[model samples]
Target: MNRLTFELRLVLRSRLSAAALLLLLLLSVLAVWSGMREVQRQRQTIERLAPLHERDVAALAARYPDSKDAGNPAYYTFYNTWDPPSGAAFLALGLRDVAPYVLRIRALGLQAQLYEGETFNPEVALPGRFDYAFVLIYLAPLFTIALLHDLVSAERQSGRLRLLLAMPDAGRLWRRRVGLRYALLFACLAVPACVGAALSASGIAATIVVLAVTAACLAFWTGLSLLVATRQWRSVTNATVLMGAWAMLTLVLPALANVALIRAIPVNQGVDLMLAQRQAVHGAWEIPRAETMRRFVAGHPEWKHQADVPGRFHWKWYFAFHQVGDESVAGAARAYRDGLVARQAWTGRLGWLLPGVGAQAVLHRLAGTDLPAQLAYQDAIVAFHREIRHFYYSYLFNDRPFGSADFARRPAFVPHAAAGMPGGTELFALFLLAGAVFAAGVWRLGRLRMHGGE
Candidate 1:
């Protein structure tokens, strides 16, 4: 205990250690604050849009009263669907900035409405958000290497390592030193997180998970640093090697994999589907009405009895051909979806080797902010788009009136839950990286011999 206390004091006295610890704490706090602000901004947008959406719907019904025809209502009316930020969304802010959380769909061709992009600055998104994920995955390890890389080697260089090892309770001495540094680093990270959670009013489970993951990450990094320090290498060499590894794992590998994944699976069929759907919907105007109704009734036998084609403009035929438009590109839609699924699967596979990528995948997956979740949103929109078509088809085919009252009673959209936190893949990857670093450090420390006191 006494020897460990001495080591802690020695570390505390170093100007570099103090500065590094302080900087980590500050950066963490900044990340937390930035993340919370982003979540709040999203919430505000959703809240503001509610009334505007209501007004838009009311205006559509007011302009095109029932008995007028379902065609006009279906043509001009827009349905608003939004995915609100989850309680824990502030922690990761995954994919939210790049994807549209608020979408305006219509009773027209569904494919056209589904792939619309959000209004975000691409330059801002290029660097990615400096949220909790960034701090934990990118910066925390650097601090760990900084504080622990010289754990034994610096003492040896200063001629105090021999004296320390010669102490009666060397294991006890080492434990105390490790504990002090670990606790100090953990506190620097945890304090900011606690404050952020409190500010966000995050759920108890979410806060606990965040803290647990943070601690686990710190423990892993500390173990690696301690192992490397055991090698008794020069502090400069240790720092260089560790930082290079961090860069490769966090930045290089993920970017390379992303490029390869995109090239391997080109999913931009989203645009092609939209264009085809537009042509099919608009081309229905030139087609014989009987042919469009034949296709619509074949797929939808329920509406066959009510099918009727009116002169000039007909809602039944208009909406029927829009359905035909969506169907026209079904093959491309499936291919696009398959491509996305492939990318997601490969990313999950990549997580096995890279802890940073692994952690990112887990966080976004848990947060329901991943690509799969985005695709799921599209699926929901497709279903709702179907319901919309059904609603219009009833009024058009059966010659029923789409009154303002009916408009208020239309089927509304229900959002799915956010995908939740890190899984075993991340835990396993973290273990592997830490284990390798520890082995190297141990070998270096074992080869080392020490002299006297500072």
Candidate 2:
């Protein structure tokens, strides 16, 4: 017990170790605050839109006080749909930083509106937000390297390493030293995160899962540092080699994997679907009215009996053409969505080999801030759009007069429930990888022996 206490005091007394821990704690706090602020902003935006959307609808209702057509209301009134952040979202903003959390869609071709208002540079989103996950995955390892890189090299340089190694309890001493540093680093990162999780009301299970991931990440770094630091090399050389390894794991490999996934998956179908849907909608103007209605009836056989349009222009016929346009590119839309899912799957698979990527995937999945989460939100929007079209179709197909009261009856958007806990596959993989590396490092340290120069 005294030995452990002495080692802890020694680590804290080192200015470098103390400063690194302090900086990491400060960064973690800032990241948590930034993430919470962003989440609040998104919620406020969603809430603000409700009243504004109501105001627009109310004004439109006043314009159509005497009008009986449901087409105008369906065409002009846009319903608000939003995906609220999960309680754990502040830990890792994930794809939410780039994807639209709120959207407004009318009863028009959905493919176009689904991807609209969602513009971001692929490069800009690659680095990710300054959330707790970023701090944990990217910054923590550097600090670990700073503290552990000179563990033995500094003693060797000062001509005490040989004497220390000859000590009867040298192994215990090294273990105590390394263990103390690891605990300190873990505390610096975990304390702020736990506080933030409590404030955000991130469920107990989620908080525990995140903390477990944090431990695995730190273990991996500590292990890697030990593996390198045990070698017979100068402190400067150890620092340089560890920094290079850091770049390889955190930056180079992930970027290369991203490129490979992009080339392999090829999700250009998003733009293709949008253009195809728009072209189909525009081409409807040149096609015969009967032809458009005929195509629409084929898909919606329930409305076949009332498909007749005697006039040159009817609300039913106009809506039928739009519906037909959406159907025209349904194949392309499916392909686009499938491609995105494939990409996300491949990224998850890569997490097995990359600790940084694994930590990120786990955090984002828990926070409901991954590509899969975005895809799920889009699926919800599609379902809601179907409801919207059917509600208006009731009035159009039956020729029922739409009134101000009927506007209130229009379908309201119900967001899907916040994302539930994700699978533990990635977490387990991270544990295995970090555990293996850390074990290897420990083994190497135990095998350390003095050479002539030592």
Candidate 3:
């Protein structure tokens, strides 16, 4: 035990180890800080919009005091719905940056509002956020390579391996050195993660999950490094190969696979739905008023009391066309949703082979910020649209007053839990892949021959 402690001191005392560890720690801290700042910015934006929305609603209510007609108020007033970031959102901002978190929708065609994306600099989003997930999945392996790629090779080159192995505790010596390096690497990575979780007030369950994932990722990196080191190649050669492998695994494969997936599953149907809704709503003007009422009454029999189209401008007719437009594209909307679900499902399956994407899938799924999570938000919007339509339709169809009092009765938007996440399967696949790689590296390490001559 004393020898092991001394070995750890020796390894950590080296300028190279100290510097590399420091750099890793610094990057991790920077990443967490950036992520938290981004989250705070989004929260502030959402909070700041509240008074604006309230004032807008108040002004419209004052302008149109006629409570009997909801049509004018619905036309002029826009209700804003925002999905605030979850407590664990900072760890992996997920699709929050690219997608619209705050959306304003009116009683007009909801299809137009549903698919409208937020204005974001694609270049900023392209590189991805510098969050804890990015650090763990992309940079952690490089640190492992830096520290362990020359573990055994350097000793052999220094004429120390033969003598060291001849000692009575040779196996113990190798374990001690490798274990010490592994622990140092773990601390350098895990400490920042702990600190970030504490500062973010992230849930205990999420923190534990993050830490376990961190350990698994480090284990994979450590095993890969020792496997390469066992080749007895030059230290420079080992580093070059490991880095090349890192690039291929982390960047190349995911990009290529994403391209292939996009090509395979085209989800441009969302745009088509929006276009169709616009056409239907505008086309209602050219058609007879009774025709629109006939169509709306077919879906909503309860509106039979107000089905009379008196050859005049009626809010009921206008709203009927709007609901019909949404119904017209319902099939296309489902197809669009299925396309996204398939994409997420396949991405989860990739976790079986690609550790980076695999772990990423797990992290975002837990945080409820993945593409599916975004879709879930969209689904919430759809449900809320139905409520908004119904709330306004009551006043329009039943001739109920929609004054300042009714504005208070307006249906509030509620976000639901993201359902049917693929984490358990993803976790299972990740461990299977990890086991396969660890086994192969173990076999290769055991078979390594040290001498130059066969």
Candidate 4:
């Protein structure tokens, strides 16, 4: 304990180590605060939209109060669907910054409405958000390298490494130093995250998971740093090698893999589905009304008895064609979604090899801000759209009137429940990689020579 305390004091006395630790702590706190602020802003936007949406629906109801056909209300009224952030979302904004969390959908061809673009500055989003995950994944490793790269090189350069190694229980001594430094570094990153979790109401299990991931990531970097440090090389060389490795692991490799994955797994089905649905919907205007109804009734046999088109612009026929349009592109929509899920799945598999990507996958999945979460939201919207169809079809098929009283019965959108924890395969892969690297580092350190000259 005394020796550990002395080593701790020594680290604290070093201006570089002390400054690096302080800077990391400050950056972590700042990142957490930034994430919290952004999440609060999103929540505020959702809250503010509630009344506005209500008013908008009320206005539409007033405009179509006396409509005898259900199509007027169905076609005119737009329901709002949104995906609320999970409690841990502030820690990692993920695709939420780029994707739409709130969307307006109607009882029309859902494919056309599902992919509406939002207005955002690409330049700003290009660099990604300043969040806790960014700090932990990208910046924390740099700090780790800075502190550990010179662990033995500096002592050797100062002509003290030989004397230190000559002491009794030198292996134990080095272990204490490395362990203390690792704990401090992990603490520097995890403390702010824990506080942020508390502030954001992130659950205890999630907080523990975040802390564990932090430790695992730090362990990987620390192991790599020590492996480089114990080599017969200068401190500058160690720093350069470690930094290059960092860039390759965190930035270059992931970018290349992403491009390769995209090429290998084509997801352009989204655009194809959209175009197909648009063609199906617009082409209905040119098709005979009886043909459209025939297709619609083929899928919805329950309404076959009410498939008669009495006029040129009957609501039942109009809605029937729209339904037919959606059905027309069902295969395309399924393919698009499968493509997206494939991309996400492959990315998760890649996490086994890339710690940076692995950490991101875990964090974003836990936060419910990944591609799967977005797809789940779309699924909810589809379910609610089904409800809308049922409600309107009741009035349209039976030739019942749609009035203000019926308008009040319009279904309000409810966001889907939060996705559970990240996938097990990714987490297992991360732990395996971290353990192997750390073990290698420990073994290399154990074999480290104590000579003053390389």
Per-structure clash totals for the candidates: 12, 0, 2, 0
Per-model TM-score on C-alpha atoms: 0.89, 0.97, 0.93, 0.96
Residue 345 lDDT in model 1? Answer: 85
Estimate, for each residue in 1-454, the C-alpha lDDT of model 4 and write its tens digit: 8988899999999999999999999999999999989888988888888899889888998898888779888988888888888899988999899988888888888887877643466797899899989998999999999999998999988889999888888888888888999999999999999999998889899998899899899999999998899998899999999999999999999999999988998876455677788888899999999999999989999998988987668988878888888898888788778888888888988899999999999999999889888889889989999999889999999999888998888787778875569878888899899988998887778776668332
Off by over 4 Å in 2: 121-127, 452-454
Q: Global lDDT for candidate 3?
A: 0.80
lDDT of 3 by residue, 1-454 (tens): 7897788687778788878888998989898888889989998999999899999888887888766688888887788888878767787888886888889998878887787673456687788788988999999899889888887788888887777766776656666676777788778777877887888777778777777777777777777777787786899999999998899889999989999999999786556778888888888899888888888889899998888967778887887898888877878888888998998888887777888998898888766788878877887887888888888887888787777787778878776663223357777777777666656655555453435201
Q: How many clashing residue pairs are found in candidate 1?
A: 12
Better of 1 and 4 by TM-score: 4
C-alpha lDDT of residue 141 in model 1? 89
What is the Cα-based TM-score of model 2? 0.97
**Collision count of model 3:** 2
lDDT of 2: 0.88
Compared with the true structure, model 4 gives a TM-score of 0.96
Q: Candidate 1 — which residues are off by over 4 angstroms?
A: 1-7, 118-121, 419-454
**lDDT accuracy of residue 85 in candidate 1:** 74
- The local lDDT score (0 to 100) that residue 444 gets in candidate 4 is 78
Candidate 3 residues lying further than 4 Å off, grouped into runs, are 118-121, 417-422, 439-454
